[model samples]
Target: MHSQQQGWAEQQDALAEFGQFALSCIDLDLILQRACELVARGLQTPIAKIMQTIPESDELLIRAAVGLPRDIATTGVTKVPGGHGSAAGYTLVEGEPIVSHIPTETRFQVSEVVRRADVVVSANVVIGATGEAFGTLEVDSLAERTFTQADISFLQNYANLLAAALDRHKAHRERVANAEERSILLRELQHRTQNDLAIITSMLRMEARRAKRSETRRRLESVGHRVEALSLVYRRLYVTGVTDAVNLSAYLDELVKRRFLMHGLEHDDAVKLDLHLTPVEVDHSQAVAVGLIVNELVTNCLKYAFPLRQGTVTVTLERVEPGKARLTVADDGIGMPDDQVRGHGIGLELTPVLAKMASGDFTLEQRDAGTAGHLVFYIPDLRGGGSKPL
Candidate 1:
């Protein structure tokens, strides 16, 4: 009775050790090896092995083993027929534990690994999960031995642990593969969108060149620039392969550079840009709104801010406080007179509405140097599905 109790305690300890390791690990072969190692110690046996059924075949391969020859255990070429002949095959066929004296066994044949290792006794149980039989885990002893009912029960439970670990590892692998596939598809779609936007911008530029009146030409050209600005956002998304958020700092920098290139202006143009920006990450929805507002403010300044002499348009985006940010576009040129709209009035009028879309407010005033527009907004929470402005 005392020996039986001690054996049960050892089994419990073995299960606990293997269970913790299995839960935290994702490697199937490593789990199997550890399971074999633990069961042998739990049962006070000299050798243990785990055989896995070959896919769509009636053959069990020696997937992992302990206390066995290096050639037979690690080479993965040892195969046991999945029939009533060998101990592993019999347990797999009958879906039951086996206690056998292999030296004088008549009910089943002896496998080569066991025969060569001089194994005389073995205890085996089927490894299975939810009507799926995976394989068998067996503990073998070189000396003559008799396995009790407690030994059989412990082996069965240990095999069940192996089956559960295999299922979990398979699920994790599938999730990783699925995420990679989705990322690839998203990048391809974004690439196609960039191509289409470029085509549209080209068409708009053609129409602008064909216009007769200066005002009509300028309006068409502004439309083209707007499309080009939006294209930069998508281009960034495609390059980064991240659709959930946008790096606002990089996008704005690119936008400013494109504007400089569009007007055929050098670094020392009559209206130069002085950008004071900080890194900011916002969700896609917030990024689009901010991008449009910045484009409009900068375009207005370039067209109407520096009319008399050389001046600089300063653009700034800074995190003012937690959950709040400010974007300022100021110029050192002629200030607005009597709250008059600057560039065609459309951009300035739409500015307030765009700011609202981003959960922000827009304000324009005559500063000491030139007209300054301020957009102050609450950053969205982006953590744990809260609004994220992180």
Candidate 2:
């Protein structure tokens, strides 16, 4: 009775240790190795191994083992052929644990390692969380030994724990792959959209050039510029590989340079650019609205503020507070009249509306030399809100 009680106590201790190991382990290879080691120690077996099923070929490859020859464990003896006779193969196919006296068993061919090791007893259990088996967990002894029903039950429980861990790892791998695929598709879509916008901008330019009336030509040119501003946002997204937020500093720099080049004033010494931009990240829809506002303000300065085409336009973006940003577009040229600033021209009318779309406030003020337009808005915290629709 004392011997029986001592055996029970040891079994309980082994189970407690295994539970702790399983809880702490995250890597599949580590878990498998530890499980095999623990099983070998608890069962007093000469060999304990885990064989993983290869889904493509329906073969069992030895993944982890203890008390097995290095060559047999690591090299050419890796795979166990799947069929009716092999103990591991049968356990996987039948989805049940089996214990057999290897010397007398004839239903299936024993593995070469088992034969060479002179193993007398072999036991195998299916390892899987669901009904479908993933592989087999096997234990063998060189001395003749009989495993009772309790022993078989204990091994099956261990196999079930392994199966659960494997299933979790498989799920995580799938999620990572799915996220990558989505990112690729989003980039492709942005590229195609930018191409379409470029085509439209070209068509608008053609129409503006053909117009005979000065007023009609100017209106067409303005519309073309607005479309081009929208196009620039998509271009920035493509170049930066960022789908969630726009890097304000890089984006505005490119935008200002492109605008000067478009107006045939990139090399003009009189027209200078003064940029004092800080790094900031803004959501997609907000970025588009800000881009349009900047385009309108800069276009106004180019056409009206600097009549001599020989002045400076300054663009500034700065984070004013924890969740706030301010953008300023100022020029050192002819100032706007109070009445025109209040009037409903394209620049004046659209600037305030676009500011509202960005959830910002807009203000126009006459500086000592030219006009300054200010836009202040709330920026989403990095920990939360992502891009929202315009």
Q: Provide the TM-score for each candidate, comma-separated.
A: 0.88, 0.82
Candidate 2 lDDT over residue span 146-212, tens digit each: 8877778778877887777677767876887997798799989999999999999999999999999
Best by lDDT: 1
True lDDT of residue 288, candidate 2: 83
Candidate 1 residue lDDT tens string, 16-58: 9999999998888788889988999999998998888888887
Candidate 2 whole-model C-alpha lDDT, 0 to 1 = 0.81
Worst lDDT 10-window in candidate 1: 381-390
Candidate number with greatest TM-score: 1
Write out the backbone clash pairs for model 2: 85-108
